[model samples]
Target: MSRHSQVRESSQLQRRLESLNTARELAEGVLPEQELQSVYDVLERAASRRSLSAEHTVVGFFGATGSGKSSLFNAVSGSELATAAARRPTTSAPLAGIWGEDGSGPLLDWLDVKERHTLPPVPGLADEHTGLVLLDLPDFDSTRVENREIVQRMVGMVDVLVWVLDPQKYADAAVHNDFLRPMASHGAVTLVVLNQVDKLSSADASAVMQSLEGILARDGLGQVRVLSASALTGDGVQTLRGAIRNVVVQREATTQRLAADVTRAATELARASGEGEARGIKGNAKARLASELSTAANVPVVVDAVQRSFKRESAKRTGWPVTRWLLRFRPDPLRRLNLGRDDTRPELSRTSLPPAGAPERARTDAAVRDFADDASTGAPGPWRAAIRGVARDGREQLPDALDQAIAGTDLKATKRPLWWVLFNTLQWLALLLAVGGLGWLGVLAVLGYFQMPVPEVPRTEGWPWPTLMVVGGVVLGIVLAISGRMLGGWAARVRASGAAKRLKAAVAAVAEQRIVEPVEVEITRLKAFNAALKAARSG
Candidate 1:
């Protein structure tokens, strides 16, 4: 491959790694730790592998015991660097064979391989295997626990995997189920060799190869190349070498390996997090939540107080002058509750309204739960639980927040109407007229008692003016008082309606801040996580 193509491939791999990291961060508390651990391990391994040699391609030979993987390793290396013995598990530790002297000591050390052999350059072959580092790994199905552990660790770290299987064990359940099946997504960098094929006739060998191909297809690795090779007669070993040379020349095995790892990890995460799109909190759900919160905050009680207080103040202003002062002894309903304040610092004071009872609290809780359920309708269990947990945590602050919202609201109940002032002036004028007429009548009575001539009172409407003035004034003042009372009652209702709206609006604000927003935030997070996972999985 050209330098430009290599750069592009490297950039793509970097983007994939970033996307995987983003997914891991988003899934931190939202997904189960066990489910997310695989992603974490993939990222760690990718980072470590990238930090090592990018110039060299590390090919590992893995197989069960008696698979002759060590013999094949030696056959490919063109030297007996690996001990091919009759022992069931000959390769205890990994053996490294360097082709072109690229200073692979650091890379080998990272792989924990103590045994290393350097192959001398052989004219045309040297160019073919320039930057190849072959590893002879321990048997995956070994009896010893440490040997199995080494194979498992090396499986993830190697750039290319070559599973060497003898015909006898090629279809072994332990090799196919435990190893090959799990690596289904890594077909790009994987190769399977049916080693020791020279032990059978050519027709039998072809039959066994066909059967192995069928099994591999079922394992989701149908695209992986399967080669027939033998260490005894060197049959097909040259083809295997040519395949390795092609991979080394392209210099894309490392990137392909890491990309496959990321893809597999992202697939697992996507499965754990359900594929459903999050439908956010519904409109009716929000409305119901606000309504329940308003009830819990005693908003109706505050609205009623506003109505009664408006009427009380109205009576003091528009009542008959003689009896209006009597209304002052009655307490203002809103004042009694320490509400309807005109000051800017109302929030500093608490209202005397009663605390929410058990039923109100229960309704509020149910509303919050229902909202969470609606928001996380199709989400996975862990994601749904996370949303509910967020809602529950935010509810702890609802009581105080609602109280402050209520106290801070401008109820507009303390404002007096213009009609009250007009009514007050008319009542005062009528009272004065009645008093003046009474005084005039009294003077006439005194004059009669003293035997003096009394002045004739003016008459209108077939009645004396003073008598008419006293009767009409008193009657007009009483009529005005009754009319004002009726008007005030209607105005009180209007004021109460306005106050109810304001109080409910305040409660809605509290509900949104304390409950709805937090739950929606969790939903939005799930959306972002899913998007990142999609990007991680994309080519």
Candidate 2:
């Protein structure tokens, strides 16, 4: 590869790593940790391996028991570095055969390979095999728990995997199902060799290879390279060496392996998160939730108080002066509930409104559940659960928040209307005129009683002025009081409607802050997480 190509490839790898990190961060609370543990381990292993060496490619030979991996290891390295023992689990620990001396030591140490062999450089093959560090790993199917553990750790840490299979156990389900199927996304850095092919004839060997390839294709590893080799007769050993050499010379195995790891991890996350994007809260759902919350907060009760209070105060201001005092004995509805306009710190003082009953609470909960369901429709199960969880948690704080919202709202019930002032002034003037007329009549009667010459009372249009004042003022004030009562009813309805709107709006705000917003936040997080997984999976 050219220098520019190398730089671009490195940049792509870095971007993939960054995208994976983004997905991991977003998936923390949304996904179960047990489902994401493998991805976490892959990321940690990638970081540790990348920090060590970029030039060396670590390829491990993994297989079941009696797979002749050690024999193949020795044949490829041209030295008896690994013992081809007849025991069940010959390679208890990992053995590293380093073809290059420059940067293999630290990489080997990172791999925790204590038994390392430095191979002598061959004249024509030195350039082809340089920087190759091959590991002979323990059998994955070993009876010893520690041996299986080592294999598992080394499988994730290696840059390339070469599965060696004997003709006898080449079709084993344990290896194919547990190992090969899971590593399907790592086809670029994977190779499967049917080792010990010397035991079969030429035609049988071809048949075995074909059968193994068929099994691999079914395991989602159709693109992986398959080879047949024999360590005993040295058949196809050079071909195997050439394949490993090509990977080393290109120096892209480490990048390819890490990229494959990221792809696999992203695929797992996508599966858990499910498909599709979050459609935000529906308009009808929000409306319904607000309505339900208003009911639960007793907004209607407050609105009724406002209407009755307005009428009572109107009667005090506009009633006939003779009977207006009677209305004062009746208590103001809103004042009785401690929700009157006189309250300056309503939020600090609880209103006398009744607590929400069971039916109100159930309706509120059902409304919240419906809202969350609508917002999370078509989302994955886990994402849906997460959104509902947020909504449920916020529901616990709703009652207090709704009360505070109701108390804080400016209902405008206590404000005096301009018409009331005009009517009040007119009533006082009528009362004074009637009182003056009565006093004049009393003076005339007293003069008649003293047997003096009574003065002729002033008259206008054939009627005494005092008589007209007395009867006309009383009749006009009574008419005005009756008109005021009718108008106050209309104004009371208008004020009640306005107060209902304001109170409902306050309740809606409480619902939004306590429930809707939290659910939306979870939905947004799930969408971002899914997007990040898509980017991580992309080339």
Candidate 3:
């Protein structure tokens, strides 16, 4: 593919992966803690540097019980470095064949092994191949399950795999399913050798090679090179040596494997970020959830408890136009700061979003915990903290969302802003001042026209129109300012409240799906992988 095509394919894959990851995260947040934690644990390890050799690659020998893996290792290194026998299950422990007399410094460091059963360098191997560090791993389907794990780990880390299958186990199910077939992605790194092919007649050996080639093709390893070799007779051993030299020495395989691994890790990290940016809800999803929950709780009609309280407090704040200005001064549910201060309290005099019963409240609390887990459980970064951020402004937001939705749906409201109060006050002051000024102007004109001394009008006792006028005019001017300020704050407050609700609702909905679905998906994937492995083993 062209570079552009490759980039586009990558981007497309990234999007699909992100959606899957998002579902997973949301699942964690809404699912039971133990299940969610399991997801987190896997994710954390998946992108991490589990194997020491980020650069050094694994080379493994995998076959049935009697495969001469250890003898081959000894033959390759010119030393009795590994134990090979019919009853022993060949090379119980992984053995390394370092290329240089200089020792496998970076190679071992990359593998992260503190020590190895060391082998002397093959004479021309080190000087010929710079980075080659070959290995003989335990059989993949050995009686020892730990050996299987060892080989499995090696497959993830290793650059090249040299399959050493004897004629009897060459078509073995254990070797195919447990060792070979599942590694479809690593076909380019695989080499198939029929060990002990010399035991058969020449025609039979050719037939076996052809049969193995067909099997490889069927296993999605169409391009894998099939070589016939007899460790007993030294047949085609030099060809195998040349192939290993091409990779282990030149260090070509590690880069390709690393590139693939790194790309997968990057993809997972991007998934942790989710698809593009989350423009949370234009309104709160949680409010939908909360409203649903409140209905479930029988909060509105069943008990008439919270809804009544909400109505009473709402009425009080909205009652008399004269005293309503005091409502402006009381507090904004969405505003953390007062008119000039930042004092915040979540306790509702009327409507509160706190979880109520042990069951319903449990669900609410569970939702918060679940959303938190969801936000966080993705790989390679501070996910829990991100989840926590989602919950930070949650309480204040849900109630506001409920309020706004209730307003838009059930009631019509030109809800006043603080600026509206100021504007009205200013306009009232302007009118009062205009009245007082007019009265004074009347007194001035009367004195000037009659040529008589104007009597000094005493200040009014009860209703101070002059003071009222000044106050009213100022209040009116403040009201005028309200228009300018309303657009942004209204938009912000409405969104903030709406988002709080939407987050609660969407998280709840998304979490609802996560309860058993994630486990189901993983189980299915694992089963498919195992089935392929078993078929390979039977080969």
Candidate 4:
């Protein structure tokens, strides 16, 4: 083939493999673990197959429990290598008989065999066979469950399988439905050996082979070679041996089969667009999800919450005197009002941004987490969490999607500003200076009242100097107090604004880190897979 044609063929094959993989994934969802493994194992082997320089063949001795595989094994090797018995499961484990001078290391590894047997080449039985491994595995149609599993697992490892069957059970449902039909894809490497055909008349033997051929054809293993062989009469064992050598030993059938499987598997890989979702969130749904998320904790929502909080604080800070508040707006006995901010904010940082609240930010965060957990009902994990809205409603809990939104984020806060400590210090100093001025003014007034020229008896009280001292102190106190209050208020405003800015930033960051980017990633993956699936389907 030309380079271009080969590339195209390779591409086509890759597509098919991916579709097969997807189908397998679907099948695995419903099938039992063992059965799924059997199907998937073929696909996996198909992937590992590569064109090899020299050929090696594996002829497997596969049959029902009482089909005399051990007898055939001994006959083919021209010696007693396998134990033929009357047990329900004749072969308890796989015993490989390699006819190769080249080490059977890799082949055995592929088959995952722990037990091995070496048989020297006999004149007719193993002639011209440099790389043939005769594998006798446990029976598929056996009462022992492990026997069946062993056979099923080893099937894909062998190149060409020589199925041994007795005349009585050749047409059994267990033989056909359990083994043949499902493996119809491997027709090119399948053969049937009617063991103990000498038990039947020549005509009956021919008739059975004919019928079996027809069944094999229906299963797509048409052209399946059939031979009448018997270990008892030694009738067709030589012919069967020659045939095995022709396919597995001389002709390098195993190598060819492996190449084809490799090509097929490569084709599947080429077709795939790679991992991720099949179909991504799209159209109205994406827009809807995003919109809903924004409504929950969007910029506007958070800003609104902060503003409301500000108004309440303002009313207290600049409103009626503290004494009047104590008498009029005392704490409500019925309501469980929080006096301090809750610790829920730090906890919520585990999965989401801090939640909104009137009093305790921590409590707000907890409520938001609870709400978000409630939102992603059918979705799996933090992957599809609800967008936790800002605390809009006056309720204790945040909207349902906050944790999902938060958990998705990396939760890395930006580095604290370098001047943050300096700024904090300046604010504290300004407040203290104003408070100190208020104390000084109070002391000056008290001293002035006492020293008002009441020293008729002694010089204990002074008039002018004391008045002057009080005047200067009062004037200095007024200026300092006024300036101090202004500076202190300014500092408070700056602090609150900075905090609000950080919060807004944190909220936006949570959206970006958690929900937005992840959704985009999932979308990209799904698109790639979908593209691959489409290409495969096209091919």
Expressed as tens digits, the lDDT of each residue in 53-93 for candidate 2 is 78888899998888889889888888787874445348888
Candidate 1 off by > 4 Å: 84-89, 122-129, 446-453
Clashing pairs in 1: none
Better of 2 and 4 by lDDT: 2
In candidate 2, stretches whose alpha carbon ends up further than 4 angstroms from where it belongs are 84-89, 122-129
What local distance difference test score does each model get? 0.87, 0.86, 0.51, 0.55
Q: Provide the lDDT at 353 for model 2.
A: 79
Can you write out model 3's per-residue Cα lDDT over 71-115, one digit (the tens) per residue? Answer: 665666566656534555366666676644243565555545433
* TM-score to true structure, per model: 0.93, 0.96, 0.47, 0.49
By TM-score, how accurate is candidate 4? 0.49
Task: Identify the candidate with maximal lDDT.
Answer: 1
For candidate 4, the per-residue lDDT at 292 reads 43
What stretches of model 3 exceed 4 Å from their correct place? 1-58, 83-89, 101-129, 262-348, 351-539
Error of 4 at 82 (Å): 4.4
